[model samples]
Target: MRGHPVTAMHPDHYESPAGLYLHIPFCVAKCGYCAFTSYPCGNAPPPDYLVALRQQAERLARHPMVREQRFATLFVGGGTPTVYGGAELGGLIRECLTLFNFDPEPEVTVEANPNSVELAKLAALREAGVNRLSIGVQSFSDRLLRGIDRSHSRAEALAAVAAARSAGFANLNLDLIYGLPEQSLADWRETIAVALAQNPEHLALYGLSVEEGTPFHRRSEQGGLALPDEETVQEMEDFAYGQLATAGLPRYEISNFARAGRSSRHNENYWHNGNYLGLGAAAVSCLGHLRFRQVPEPERFVRLINDGAPPFIEMEALPPAAAFRETVIMALRMLEGIAVAELAARFGVTPQDYYGKTFVRLQAQGLLAVEDGFLRLTARALPVANQVLAELV
Candidate 1:
């Protein structure tokens, strides 16, 4: 059931975010595999996008969640957060943290492209309270990188990390992708080695999926691509998982891993159903019970917020049952699975009551088990998570 059209939630009913997320929707160029609403080399965005972001943050600050609680996690991800540069970007970020009441030691994170990470901009952000950086080092091999149309060279990524370290930014993260066309299991190994060599506090490794409307998706549809076979893809994933775990960054989620205390607390807020407000174009927010979408056009966002109103494109507040379903799907992404007692505590029903049949069926296949009253997926389930999550859906 849809509730009121409120953008902010009362913290007493909703789970307060240990973290916050701001969607920086500008990219220098969109990757072949990316379907997010990012335009590279397209239009010169107005300086007012930053103002609108601050408006969104300040608007939500009036809510009980922002007024009463402090954020433990803060992630500003994008098309490319670094595209905006240092002073301009830093000022906007500072405005947001103050509005949201984020903790001083919050895990502040921003997504960066290897091409975007320079010494000057990197240092500016560190001074502005950005403690973590997530750079897109999608592939180290120039051949594969060109195949994906990533903007950075392997050397640039390496140099960026060095620059970050020299700038006194120790909590660096590298994001990589596997399962590209013509990439061997050995190729995955080399990429992993290069990333681990950096000794980043966090790592995010994603399996390649050809999302609809993306350049990669179009290429696959036209038979212009040749993805690795499923067996080899599985083998690649398995090898990377084991490799990262051994390299001091263990797997924390199906597609992400980190060293101790670096498991992306901002994302963990999402996994645990923590409420967060998304700012900027195409940014999404789930606060209180209302889930809302913002306008995707940069110009439109500027115009709307300038009009003294948040330009929410869509919104939905969940009923208790729907919220329960959402919580199940989100929490299930963790290897820890869903906590049975916790689910019952929140929803007033056991896991067996809401999703008993699916759980029992998956358990019979040795893909799931209930241990200590928590439902968890086995390692085997991870490899076929799409299929497993489908059962729950």
Candidate 2:
């Protein structure tokens, strides 16, 4: 099946977003291990890019689907949103709230790098109605941080948290990465200890994956990288889960842990197959049944929008079977899993019927089980979830 064209968008065709995502593709410096669609902009973001962002926002607001829907959450993510300066970023956010209908108490989040955030910036974002902050503190170990080319030092990471607290931002998330070159178990433990001491409401712990085109990938291919062995990495993951749970932030997803009521609503929307509209360069939007991504280059995106053309570089209308497969894959990432009856109702086929022998075989191997009307991975399967999801897909 093919997705409908962008021209086919209508009020009735809208699958209302649970949230909105605005991507700021500019950063002061790109990290060696980063593969996201972000570029370096020294000192501050280009003024022209901000103007283009506004244009994109205006154009999106004019869409029938956007005009008719009220978003429940908003996430400003980036190369580093704080790089745009708090006042400028605040104005852009204010414009969005004015242009769209949002829930009275929407969960507004912005991603910040420890090196970029300051007390003044935090205050501006708070004044702009941002209630949540996801700060990238990658590691508290200065040595490990320098190895990964992180701009922030240990002191900066700690100070960022203090500043956020001082600015009256109570709901905070800290992002950490493990399995980096020269990152030992002790190093990870200390990082976790420092992060927990900050008392963030949420945490996202990710294992390092050296993506192609990243500097880390080249280092690995040439045998210059010294990443921990798989066993050590697994130990680190286990330690993190245990520590965070003890800290009262239980694991809510494979890579995320949160205190009660603090889970990321925007990300949960994605996990549950809820629709969202993304704006700005390199943003991806899934509206109705179509998935599309805007042009990645900032200049190209701005130029195309100025030309009155859709900036999308790729799009796909998901087939029913493909959609069902995706729904299962995403939902299974959560600890609660997916309801069997609900899946059957939506897709017109039960897991047993759709997956046939693969489903049954996984169950027999103790990797999957049907319990409490939901299909879920067993504890043993969580570590090898990729292999299990591969079979289903």
Candidate 3:
């Protein structure tokens, strides 16, 4: 009787091998640019949080089909995954692995902030089987770091890579941001140069977008903060996109680049519309056409999970039409673009029937091209990608 409910949730819905995303919603100091749900450093999660986490996983495993499923990728991200220090983190990782079936060579990634990286801790994570590190080095300039409220120093961010290398982590990705309030094109070039000099396996470059409700947004609305004009921002992206591609880290997606074989498998799961399950407060999970997310408030999430539930605000089962639209939306985000056959299989509709008009219009505008069974956005249309995507939506 206890196992009956797990079987009824329908394992066929998660037909594809799933990916696991463990959100560590704890941070040292919140960055001005961040909007993720995370508690501050001093406010660590309650000590027994792991027991609740294990409970949730245990429940998931009780589901008949889920019991046998293995994850293709495992991503540990969040409010600075290293904020709790190594011992706590190691326990969480071990518990997760013990609870779920993992791929033979799952791409294991942990997001780290330079401020929290100690050589010993990094080595511990490595020894505990973390093969990839995604370091947040928002800027190499101390001036920009301070302006953005980043807790790490320029030296610390720089030294993190060296430290990771010393600890034997080769699959490293650096995160950089552009379009600062007082940054110049030359400064951006220098930033890019410094990042390239590190010879990272992958890099992610994000334009500074002040989301509504963020401190940056409020200040900008009050006219106290100045942002670069749209034209300047576009030019900045164009410069970086071209420069990075030329430097051999060609843009795989709009803002992400990888050196040869180092693309983030976890992120690719997102843009490619693959199956992924998220844990931790406010983390979202997508299985088949059903999407669910934990309540963003950490305490609330813990309470719900403690009550023997998934801690989500709601479980929304997307209709086939909605799912088709989403597939088109996410697929267009990739440089490899959407495959006709995959879309057809997922949506039960012909790509031509579903997106014929938008495809023709985009192609006539020289912004996209449809090849044998695939449709991809051209480099020219990438900066104005939203405009192109809106037509299909």
Tell me the tens digit of each residue's lDDT in model 2 across 263-380. 9999998987878899989899887678889999999988988898899999998776777778789988888888887776666677777787778789999998899999888889
TM-score winner among the candidates? 2
Model with the higher TM-score, candidate 1 or 2: 2
* Candidate 3 residue pairs in backbone clash: none
Candidate 2 residues lying further than 4 Å off, grouped into runs, are: 1-17
Write candidate 1's Cα lDDT for 274-386 as tens digits: 67777778888776667889899888988998888768899897776667766767787888877777776566666566665666677899887788888777877877777
Candidate 1 weakest ten by summed lDDT: 1-10
Select the stronger candidate by TM-score from 2 and 3. Answer: 2
How should the candidates be ordered by lDDT, best one leading? 2, 1, 3
lDDT of 3: 0.78
In lDDT terms, how accurate is model 2? 0.88
Model 2: number of backbone collisions: 1
Give candidate 3 regions above 4 Å deviation: 1-16, 43-46
Q: Higher-lDDT candidate among 1 and 2?
A: 2
Q: What is the lDDT of residue 279 in candidate 1?
A: 75
lDDT of 3 by residue, 214-245 (tens): 77888888897666777777777888788788
